[model samples]
Target chain A: MATVAGHPETPLIEPVDRGEGLGHSIVRALSHAPLTILLAFIGVMWLVPTLGLFFTSLLPASVISSEGWWTIFSTPSNATLENYRNIFSDEAITSALLTTVWISIGSTILPIIVAALAAYAFAWMDFPGRDWLFIGVIAMIVVPIQMALIPIFSLYDRVHLFDTLAGLILFHTAFGLPLAIFLLRNFFVGIPGELLEAARIDGASEIRIFTRLILPLSWPAIASLAIFQFLWTWNDLIVALSLARSTQPITVAIFTQLRQFGANIEIIAPAAFLSLTIPLVVFFAFQRYFVQGLLAGSVK
Target chain B: MTDSSITAEPPNQGAPPTADEAGADPGRRRRFLVALGFLAPALVFLGVWIVYPTVYTVVRSFYDRSGDAFVGLDNYGTLFTTDILLTAIRNNAIWVLVVPAVVTAIGLVFGVLTERIRWSVAFKTAVFMPMAISMFAAGVIWHIMYTQDPSQGTINAAVRVVSDAVNPPGVLSGAAPSGDDLRGSAAQGYRLQGELKAGEVAHLGLTRIPASEVKDGVQAVVPATVEGGITGVVWRDFKPGGGGTAGEVEDGEVGIPGVTLRLTDASGAEVATATSGADGVFTFPDVGDASYRLGIASETFRESYGGVSWLGPRLITPAIIIAYIWVWAGFAMVVIAAGLAAIPRDVLEAARTDGATEWQVFRRVTAPLLAPVLSVVFITMIINVLKVFDIVLSVAPPSVQDDANVIALAMWRTSFGGVNDFGLGSAIAVFLFLLVIPVLLLNVRRFRREA
Candidate 1:
C-alpha cells in the first residue's frame, strides 16, 4: 500500500505551490475581496427592495399609504401583521399564491429534466442534424414572446388547455427549454469527454453514463437552470394573464391591485415584496450557481 | 490513454451491434431519430406561435378595420396622409431614435463608472434594480411621479414651484401680456414716454437686443389690481441659433404664453413664431419652406437631478439620451467585470517579469483578451436597444403616446389598443421583426463562435 502511494515513478507530477502561514492568508483574503464585495453588493441590492416589500406586507394597509416604508424603522412601535393576515384570509390571494407555487415548481422541474437530456444528447451523442437541431433551438430566442402570445392563446383555446395550469406549465416549459438547452449544452460540452468515454468503456450503458457521469458533473448548470426557470416562471405575468383563469399566479394577483383605483401603497408594497420572497430565497441559496450560469454562455 | 481505454472496454459495451454486417446502416437510422426528436417540440411551439403570427400580421395589413375585405396598400396610404397616424409615426421615430440611444448610453457610462467606484456593486444594483421590477411595475412608479393635476405628483409639484416662482402670485388666471409690454419696457429704459394701451398704436424700439438676454422660464412678475395679483406679465422665451423667425400671431386668440403664431399684415406678409401652442402644435402659415426657430419648455424634473431648469429641451434629443444611458452602463459593467476576472494570473506575472507597468499590462495585455467579451456585450446591447419597447411605452403618457411612441409600442397600439386592428398591427410587427433579423443573425453567429 505504501509503495502504491509513493510509486517512486510518482507519475512525474507538476510541483504545486502551497504558500504558507500569514502569506497564504493574506493572498487568500486579497484574492477573494473583489468577489466578496461583488457578491455582497448583489446580496444587499436584492435584499432591500424585497425586504421593503415584505415589511410593507406585514403592516396594516392604512399606515403604508400615509408614510414611506423607511419610516417604519423610525416608528417601529406601531407595526402590525394585518396585511399578511389579509392575504391569507382572502381566498383570492391565497389561491393565487398556491397556484404560483405549483406552476413554478412544476415548470422548473420539467424543463431542467428535459433540457438536461436534450443537452446531453447534443453534447455527447453523435448524431446527424445535431448541429442543425441546436441552431434551430437557438433561433427560438429571437422569436419575440409578444408575437407568440395571441397565437399560443388561440392554440390553447382550441386544445381546451386555455384555462388550465397544465397550459401555463406547457408554455413556460416550451419557451424555457431553448435557452435552457443552449446554456446547459455549452456547460456539458466543457465536461472532460474522457470521463464519459471512460464510463462507457467500463460496460456502462448510455443511460447509465448520463445518469451517473453527465448529470452529476452538470449539477452546477442544472441548479442554475432550475433557479432561473423558477424565477422567470414565478415573475411571469403575461402568459399567466392570457392563459390562467381565476387560478392566477402571484404576479397576476399583484397586477389586480394595480387596477384597484386609488390603490393603496400598503397592499401593493407588501404584496410585491411578499411575491419576491421565494425568488430572493432561491437566489441566495444558489447565488454561486446563478452567477456561474450567468457567465456560462457569454464568457465562454 | 484513449486507444487502450477503448480496447479495454469490450466491443460489446459501447460498440454498435454488428447488424451493419447484416446490411443495415446505423448512422442513417440514428440521424432520422435525432432529427425527429430534436426538432419536434421546438418546431411545434415555434411554428404555431412565431411563424404563423408573423405571417398572419403581414397578411392582415392588407385588410380594413373589419379585416374582411382586401384593400391593398390603402392602410399604407392612410398611414402616409392621415394626420393622427402621421403624428404617431413622428412620435415613434422620436421614440426609436431617443430611447435606445439614451438607455444604452446611460447603461454603458454607468456600467463603466461604477467599475471604478469603491461600492460599485451597490450602485450597479441600485440602477439595475429597476430592471428586476417588471416594466409594468416601473410604469407604476413613473406613473405616480408624472400623475398630472395632482400637485402631489413629483413632476407636477416641481413644475408648480417653478410656475409660482416665475409668475409670482397669479400665473394662469389671466391671459399672457402681449409683445408690446416687452418693447415698451425697452422704450421706458430709453426715457421715451410711450403709452401702450389695448387697440392703441405706439412707436417702439427695434434694437434687436440679442434674444440670449431672455432665459427660458424667466417670467416677468408685475403688480395687479385684481385678487389674482400678477397680471399682464410677458413671457420672453430666449432661443439662440434657432434660425426660427420671430412669431407672427395668428388671427385667433393666443391660448397660452410663448405659443407660436403666424402674424400677417393686412397686405398678407408672412411671419412665423418658433414657439407653439400649449399642445406643442406649430403652424406653418405662408412661410414657403423656410427655416425657423422654436423655443420649447418643460417644467419636468428628472429624479437623478433635483430641482428643474428649462434648458434647451429639444423635442426628442434629451429623451433619447436619457434612455440610452439607463440601459447600456449596466451591460458594460457586467461584461467588463467578467473579462477582468478571466485574466490568468501567470500572464500578469509574465508582464511583471517583463517590467511592464500595471497600467501597461492592463492596456496591452488585459484589454486585448477582453475583446471577445466586449464584442458580445456590444452586439447584445445594440440588439437589446433596438428592440426596446417598455421604457418608451412607460415613460410617455397615452395622450402623447401616439406622437412619441416607438415601433414596438405602435405595433402594440395597432393590435390591442382600442382600435384592435390586427392586420395593421401584424404589418408593423412584421416590419419590426425584419428590422431585428440582422441583429438576431449576428447574435446566433456570435453564440456559435463564442460558445
Candidate 2:
C-alpha cells in the first residue's frame, strides 16, 4: 500500500478487505475508479512534457522545427541519435561533463569525510564548549550562499582559485558541511556508548575508534549524506555560474548554450537530457537512502 | 585508576589528590585536544567559507561602490529606489506568494491520491522524475514548450488547435479595402457608400492582402447580376507591380475568398448574409426590392488568433514560476508522501468506522496531521525560491530578463554581470539574508525541538 520503507510499522492506507471474494474485490476496486483516473491523469500530465522533450531530442532538427513533438508517434522512423552523437563529440560538452563528474565526486567525498570526523567528536567525545560549537555550526546552515558570494569571489580571485575546479569543489564542500554534520551527528548519537567504551578499554586510540567503529557503524547515515551531497553538487548552477568561469559544470554549460544559442534544441536537448540522466540513475540505484536522507534532513 | 585513588588517600582526611589524580588532568586535556583535532578540518572550512564571508558581506554592504569610501546605508537606499531592483523585489514577492502554495498543494493532492491507486509506485516515479534533473534542464524543457511558433511549441500548438476549433479565424485578416467606396474602420464593418437596389451590382476591392494568404484557385471574376438581389465581387484589386486600376477586378488578380458580406437596410438592420465563393463572387438572391448598403462583416477582417506570448513581459514571471513548480512539485510530493506513510493507519480507520465522510476525515484529521510536513515543504520551498537563479536565467528571454528578475538574479547581475558594483551587490545579498533569517530561525527551532 505504498508505505514508507523507513517507517514499516505504519502503512499509508489500510486495506479494507484482505480475504474477500473476487466479486467483493472487484466492487472495492470499482469504488476507487475515480481516484485511479485522477491519479492517472496527474501522472500523464507530469510525464508528457519530459516525454515530448525526449522525443524532440531524438528527432532530426528539421523535423523538430516543422512538426510538433507529438507527431513522433505517427512517424517514429524520423527519430535519430545524431543530436546525442553531436553533443558527445563536442569538446566543450565532454569537458563540462568531466568537470561535473569530478566536481560532484570531490564535493561529495570531501564534505562526508570532514563532517564525519566532526560529527564523531560532537557525538562521543567530551570537549569544552562542544554543545555550543555544534549549535554555532548548525546556525550557519541558514546563511544563504548569496551572503558568501561577493567575498568569496574576491577571495578566490586573490588566491588564484577563481575559475578552477578545486575552487568550486571547495565551495560545495564547505556549504554541504552543516547539514551533513547535523545528519551524521544525530545518527552517531544513537549508537550505544558501550561499543566505544569497550574499544577504549582494549586500548584503541581516538583515531582508531573513529575509523574502525564509528565510521563502520554509521554507513546508512553516511550513504544518505553522500547521495544528498552528490546530487546537490551535480544539480548546482548558481555557484558554478558565479565562481567557475573556465571550469564550468554541465548545468552552467547548458545554461550558457540556452542563452547564447536561444532554443537551439539540437544542442540543448541532448546535453540537458544527459546532464539529468546521471543523477536519475544514481537516485534510483540508491533510492532507499535518498528517501531516508530526505526525511532525516527535513522531517526531523 | 579508582583503586589507586581509594588507596592513596584516606577518606576521613580531606587531603590533596594523589599523583594519579594530577595525571588525570593532562589525560582530560589530551582528550580535549584530540576532539579538537577531529573537528579542525570542518572548523576551518566553516570559518573560511561561511562565517568569514557572511561577516564580510554585511560590512561590505555599508561601503561605497569602490569599497575605499564608507557610505552608510546608501546602497540599501539605492536598492529600494532603482526601478530594475524594485521589479526584482516585486517579482520575488509574487514568486513567494504563488510558488510554494501551488507546489505544496499539488504535492498534497498527488501524495493523497497516489495512496488510493494500485499503481501508486509508477505514478510517484513519473511525478518525481523531474526532481532528479537540474533546474536548468527543466527550464530548457519548458522554454521549448513555450516557444512563440505554434508548430515548434507544443503548448502554443495545442492552444491554437483548440482556439481555432472554437472560433475560426479570418482568412483575409490584414486585407484593407481600396478606393473611396468603402467608408468605415477596420474594427467596424466596411460599408459601400452608395445605396444599391436589388438588380444593382457592386464591386468591392481590397488591398494589402499577403501573397502567402491568398489561396489557390481563387480567380477575380465579375459578378453576374441575379434576378431579385444584388451581386458583388470582392477581390485583390492591386496586382503585382501595381498595374491594376483601383476598385476594379483586373486579370490575374486573385479573389479574396471567404469574405462574409452583410446586407443591411437604411435602418441598419441586417437582411441577409452571403459568403463569397472561391471566385470572389457573392450574390444575395433573396434581398427584397429595397435600398441597401453592402457591408463586409467585421469578423472577416479581424486578426487571426496566434497563441499567447508566453515569454512576453506581462507573463514572463508567471511563466517562469510555472516551470519552477513543475521542477519542484515532485519534491514536495515525495516529502509529503513520506509524511503520509508515517501516519498511523488505525486513526484513519477509526475515523472512517465512526461514519466520518472522506472529506471530513481529510479536512479535519488528515490535514491537521500533515501540517508539519506541509510546513516543511512550504518553508523549504520559500528558501529555495528566494535563492532561485538558474531557471530564471535559462527560461527568460534576454529582452525580458529584467521583467522576470528575482532578488537573487538581480544580485548576480549587479555584482557579476558587468556591473561590478560589489558594494550594492553585497547589500542586496545581505538584504536577502535578512529576509531569510526568520524562516531560518523557525527551521532551527524545529530542528532543535526534534533533536
Candidate 3:
C-alpha cells in the first residue's frame, strides 16, 4: 500500500526488502538534504527582517533598540501602542492617512471600472481599429513617468491642479488605465462567449449583459485588479508626491518623520510597521481572487 | 440566475454570423463610445500632466532660467561643458550601470529558488514587503543602513562586531591596526584634510582641527615661494594678514575668490599656502602619495565645508530592478506553482512506467506544457517593468535630475520639481509612448494567437 506522508492516501508504504534498498534511500536523502537546507536558508533570510519589523512595531520604542524584536516572547509587558497613537495624534499624519485612503479608494474604483469597460470593448465588442486602439492604450504603459512629470506638472499648474487631491487621483487613474485594461481585458475574454450570448438571447442589451453576466463571472478578476490597483496607488509615492504637491500621503508624512526622527527606532520601527498594515489588509481580503484572476487567460 | 432562456437554435442565425461578426457594426459604435469614454479621462489627465508639460520642458530646456529669451541649444551646450553637469552625468551613468543588472540577477535567481519551498508564501511576502513601502521610505531605510557610524547603523555595527571579534582593531570603524609602522620615520609629513567624522579612530593621515584655529592654521602654512622640492621646513612661511614674504595672490589654488588654501603634508604638518590668481588659479607644490581636500565657496550650491549633494531618496534602475523582482517574483511563483499543480499525475506515471528519466520527462513534458504560463509571466513582467517610476524617483540624485532622466522619473520631475518644463517633458513622453507600443502590441498578438 502506498501512503503519502502528508496525504496519507498517496504515499507508498511498502516495507518489503528494507535492508536491500537501504543504500538507495540514504543516497536519495543525501541528495535532497541540500534542497532542504537551501529552502530553509532562503525562507529565514527573507522572513526575519519583515518579522522583526512586525514585532518591533508592536513593542515600545526603547525595547526595539536595546533588545532583539524576537525577545518579545520573554517580556510581554514591554509592548505598547504609543507609536500608533502618536501617528494618529498628528494632524498632518491623520490628514495624510485620510488622503491616502481616499486616493487609494478613488483610484482603484475609477480605474477598475474604466478598465473593465474598456476591456469588455476590446475583448468582446467588435469595432474598427479595435486591435490598434488597444495597442495604443497598451503602448501608453511604457511612457515612463519621468518623461511626463514636468509636462504634467506644468499642465496641472496651468489648469490650477497644482496641489489638489482630485488632481492626484486623476493623474493616477490616467497612468493606471493602460495596465488595468490589459489585465481585465484578458480575463473578460476568457469568459465563455456563450455566457454573454446566452444572456443576450433573452433580450438583455449589451449593457445589461455586461452588468449581470460578465461582471458577476468576472468578479474574481475585478477583485484581483482592485487589489493590484489599490496597492499600486497606496504604495505610490512619486506620483502622489508630485501631483499631491500640497497634501501629503502616508509615504511623504512617514518620510518627514524619518528626517526628524534620526535613529529613534521607537518611532521608525512602529511607523514602518504601521505603514504596511493597509496593504496587508487589502491583500488578505483579495488574495483568494488573485489565483483565479491570474489563471483566467492562461488556462483556456 | 439570469432570466435568459436556453435556445434550441443559437442566436447567431439572424445576427451578423456570430458574436465576433454580430457586433461588427454596433461593436464599432459601442467601441468608439467606450474608447471615447475610456480615453476621455485619461487623455484629459495625460494631456495636462504628460503631454503638455513634456512639450513645455523641451521648449524650456532651450530657454534661460527665466524662460523669457530664446537660446538655441545653449542650455544643452552649457550642460555638456559645465563641470558640475559632467559629474552629474557620470554619477547618473554609474547609477544606470550598477542598479538594473544587480537587481534583476538577484531577483531572478531568488525567484526560482524560493518557488520550491513549502513556505513559499511567507518567504515571498517578506521580500515583497519592501515593494509595499514607498520609494521614499525605502530610501530612508537604506540611508540608515548605509549610515557611516556603527553605533547608529545596523550594517556597520554588525560588520564592526564581527571584525572586532575576529581581527581585533574593528573592521568597519577604522584601520584594522595591522600593527604596521604608520607613525615611524615613514610618517615625516602629512596633510590637513577634513571630512564628516565619527568618534576617535586612527586612519592613515587624517586629523581633527578645531573650528576656531582654521584661519590661523592656513596662515602658518603659506611659504614665500612654493618652489619645487620645497622639503620639510626647507620652505619659509608667511600669512595673508601680515602681508609678509608670501605674494599678494588674488585668489587661492581652488580658484574661488574668498576661499584660501592651507596645504599640509601626509602627517598633518602644515607646509605652505597660496591664494587664487585673478584668473582663479591657486597653485601649490605637488606631494607624493598625499591626499588633497577641497573646499568650495559658490553662489549656486551652498554648503559649509563638506556636504554631499544629490543624496535624495531615490532608486536608480538597479534598485528598481531589485525592488521590482521582490514585488513580482511572488506573483510569478504563485502562477507557476498553480500551473505545476494542474499537470496530471498520470503524465509523470506514464513517463516513469516508460523507463524515461525524471529530468527528461519533466523537461520535454512539463516545460512544454508550461508554455502558456511562461507567456503570461513574461508579458506581466514586461508590462510591470515598463511602468516602474516610484523606485527610481525615490532614490535618484536630488539636485540635477532633468529630462535626460528615465521616462517615468522625468515625467514626475518636470511636472512638480519646480521649473515645470512641460514641452520637452512631453516630447520625451511621446517617445516613451512610442517605446511601449510594441510591447503592448506583442501582448495583444499573443492573446490573438491564443484566441
Candidate 4:
C-alpha cells in the first residue's frame, strides 16, 4: 500500500493508488460519503425540473391534462414521439428553426471576423487614440440593449431593414463585437510580439501578416469567441423580438405559443426542446473552449 | 507618402534605430492608416448600433411621444409617476436585491462542495446544462412547472402530495348546507338558524358532494343522546333518486366525516370545538348547560389543498427570479469553480495542519480568497438581471405581465408592445443605462488595472 501521508488533518480523503482494488475505492468513496451525497442531491435538484419537462413533452395532450408526468414512470408505455413528429411537420416551427440557424451563423461569423481584425489592430498595430477607442468599445459592453432599441427601431424603419433577418443579425453582431474584441484583443496581446515583428521584418504587408501569422495563431481565442457568440445569438430573444417580426427565430416562435395561455403545449414542448438541442450539442462538443472563453472574458 | 516611407526603411529593424532613421512622421502616419483599416468595420458597427442610438435615445427622451415636440422632463416625470412603470421599477429593485446574492451563494457552495468528490464532473455537467439552453426554453419548462392545475404541473403535484400527507383535506370540501336551518355562507362559518341548549339534538344536512369523493369506512347513523352537550348528525342529505325527504339522512346517503363543528355563545365567541367521527356524530361535551349556537367551522368547508399559484401577481416577480437563477447559477458556478481551482491548495492544508477546523478554514481562508471571483459573478449577475426581458415575457401571463414587469420589459412595452410611446420608452432606456453605469465603471477599472 502506497501510504499518501501529506496532510493527516484534511477532512477529505485522498485518492488511493490505481492498482488498489474496487473495495479500496469503495471505502475511499464512502469515507467522503456525506459530501458526495450532498453533491448528488444538489445535482438531482438541478436536473429534475428539466427532466420533468422532457418527459412531459413525450406525453400526449389528453394524458398530460389527466395525470402528472411522473406517472410515466409507472406506465412507461405512454411515451411517444408524436410531439416531435408534429412540431417537425408544422410549417411555423420548421421555418423558425431554419431562421435560427441562419441568424446564429451570420451573427457568429460576422462578429468574429470584424472583432478579430479590430483586435489585431488594438493589440499589435499602433494608432492615434487607440487606447481611448478600445475603452469606448469596452464601455459599450454595458450599454443596455434597451438604450439602442428606440433609436435603432427608427433607423431600421428608414433603412428598410425592419423585420428582416439581416437586420436582426446586424443588431446581434453589433452588440456582440464589444466583448468579442475585448476577449480576442486580450488573447491577441498575449501572442509573442517577436513573431509579428519577425513577419514585419520579412517584408510581409499588414494584411498578409494578419492573415498568415495572426489569425492562424489566434484560433483558440477565435474558437472560444465563436462558440460564445453562437450561443448568445442562438439564445437571443430581446434583439430578435424587437427587430424582426416576420423573421422570428425559434425563441420568439416558441414564445408566441407560450403567450396563448400555454395552449398547444404539445407544440411548445417539442419546439423548445428542439430549439435548445443545437446549442447544447455545440456547447458539449466544444465545452472546453467555451469555458475557457467564459473565464477569460469575465475575469481580468 | 507614408506607404512609400514604410518601404524606404532599412532592413536593420532588430538593431535599435535612431529617431530620424525610424521614419518618424510618415511611418507613424502609415501605421495609423493600417490600424484604421483593420479597425474600420468594428468602429462603424459600434458607432451605428451602440453609440449613435445611445445618444439618440437620450435626446429622444426629452421629446414628446412623437419625437417632434420638445417636452423636456415630462417623460422623466411620467416614469416616476406612472403606476405600471413604478411597479416595473419596484420589481427591478427586487430582482437586483435578491438574484445576485442568491446566485453567488449557491455557486460558491456548489463550487466548493464538488471539489473533493469523484462525481464532481457529472454534478457540474448537470447543473451547467441549463446555461446551454435558451431562456425561452427555460421559461417554457418553468411555465409548465408553475401551472395551477396539480395534474398538469409537476411542482404543484409534488406540493399537493406533501400537503395531503401531512394534513389531509376534509370530506366537506364541496359540501354545502341543504336546509334553511343553516344560515351563514362558507366565507362566514355556517351556523344553526336557532340557538340550541345542551341535550338538544341538531340535524345538520349537507349536499353537492359526489359519492366518489366521500371517504371509505364512513357510515351515516342517528346520533345517540349525550349528556351536558349539543349533539349533531352531519350527513349527506340527498338521496340518489331524490325520493328521500328534504333535510333528512336516508339509507343511501353517507356520513360526511371530518366536519368540525364550533360551539359559539350568543356574542359570537367560540366556546368549544368538536370533530365528526366515522358515524357523523359530533358531541361538544362538558358544555355548561348554557344556550349556544351550533356552527360549522369555515375551514371544514374550504376548498381542497390545491397547489400555490406560483405565477400569480404576488409571486410572479419572485417566481421569475427563481427561473432566472436556474439559468444563470450554472454560469456562476462554472466561473467560481474555475476560480476555486486556481486557489493554492497548500494554504488550506497549512491551515488544517495549524489546527484550524474545516469551517474556520473555509470562513477565514477560503472566503476571502474567493472574494474577487464572487464579486465578478455578483457584478455580472447584476448586469444580466437588470436587462431581464425575455424570461419575464415568456413566463408571465399577459394579464399579470405588468405586475411582473421590470425596467427593460417596461422599455420594450412602452415603445414596441402596442403603446408606441417613443419618448417615455427612450426615457426608460436612458434610465436603464444610468443604472448600469456604476457596474460598467467598476469593470472598466478592473480591466485597466489588469492591463
Candidate 4 residue spans exceeding 4 A from truth: A1-34, A65-67, A74-78, B1-21, B24-27, B176-207, B215-302
Give per-residue CA lDDT, model 2, range B1-451, as digits (tens). 1011100111222111222334577798887799899999999999999999999999999999889999999999999999999999999999999998999999998887777777888888888878777787888888888988787788888888888878887776676788888878778878999999988888988888888777653778997788888998988887887777887787888887888899999999999999987788899996887899898998787665567899999999989998889888888888888777766677777766765556656765677667767887887788889888888988898889989999999999999888989999999999999988887666555444433
DockQ of each candidate relative to the true complex: 0.11, 0.36, 0.18, 0.33
lDDT of 3 by residue, A102-170 (tens): 988998898777777777766776546667766566555555565555556656778987788887888
Measured by DockQ, the strongest candidate is: 2
**Best first by DockQ, ranked:** 2, 4, 3, 1
RMSD of 4: 8.4
Residue-level lDDT tens digits of model 2 in A56-168: 88988888878878888899899899999999899999999999999999999999999999988888877768767877777777678889999999999999999999999
lDDT of 1 by residue, A1-300 (tens): 101011122122223343344533443454456655764654464345334555555567666555445556888865787776666787877788899899999899987777777776777665556677777777766655556554565568799988899889878887787788777776777677677767766968666777888888878778877877887788777678766667698777766776566665566555666666677577656655655555554311
State how far residue B73 of model 2 sits from its true place (Å): 2.4
Off by over 4 Å in 3: A1-31, A54-79, A259-268, A291-300, B1-121, B124-136, B169-332, B335-389, B392-415, B418-441, B444-451
TM-score of structure candidate 1: 0.62
* B50 Cα displacement, candidate 3 (Å): 5.9
Q: List the candidate numbers ranked by lDDT, top first.
A: 2, 4, 1, 3
DockQ score of the complex predicted as candidate 3: 0.18
lDDT of 1 by residue, B182-270 (tens): 32222112111232222222211122323332323332232132321111222322223434223332222122334323233234343
Q: How does candidate 4 score on lDDT?
A: 0.81
Q: TM-score winner among the candidates?
A: 2
The runs of at least 3 residues in candidate 2 whose Cα sits more than 4 Å from the true structure, single-residue gaps closed, are A1-34, A59-68, A71-78, A261-265, B1-23, B176-257, B276-285
> Scoring only chain A, what TM-score does candidate 2 earn?
0.89
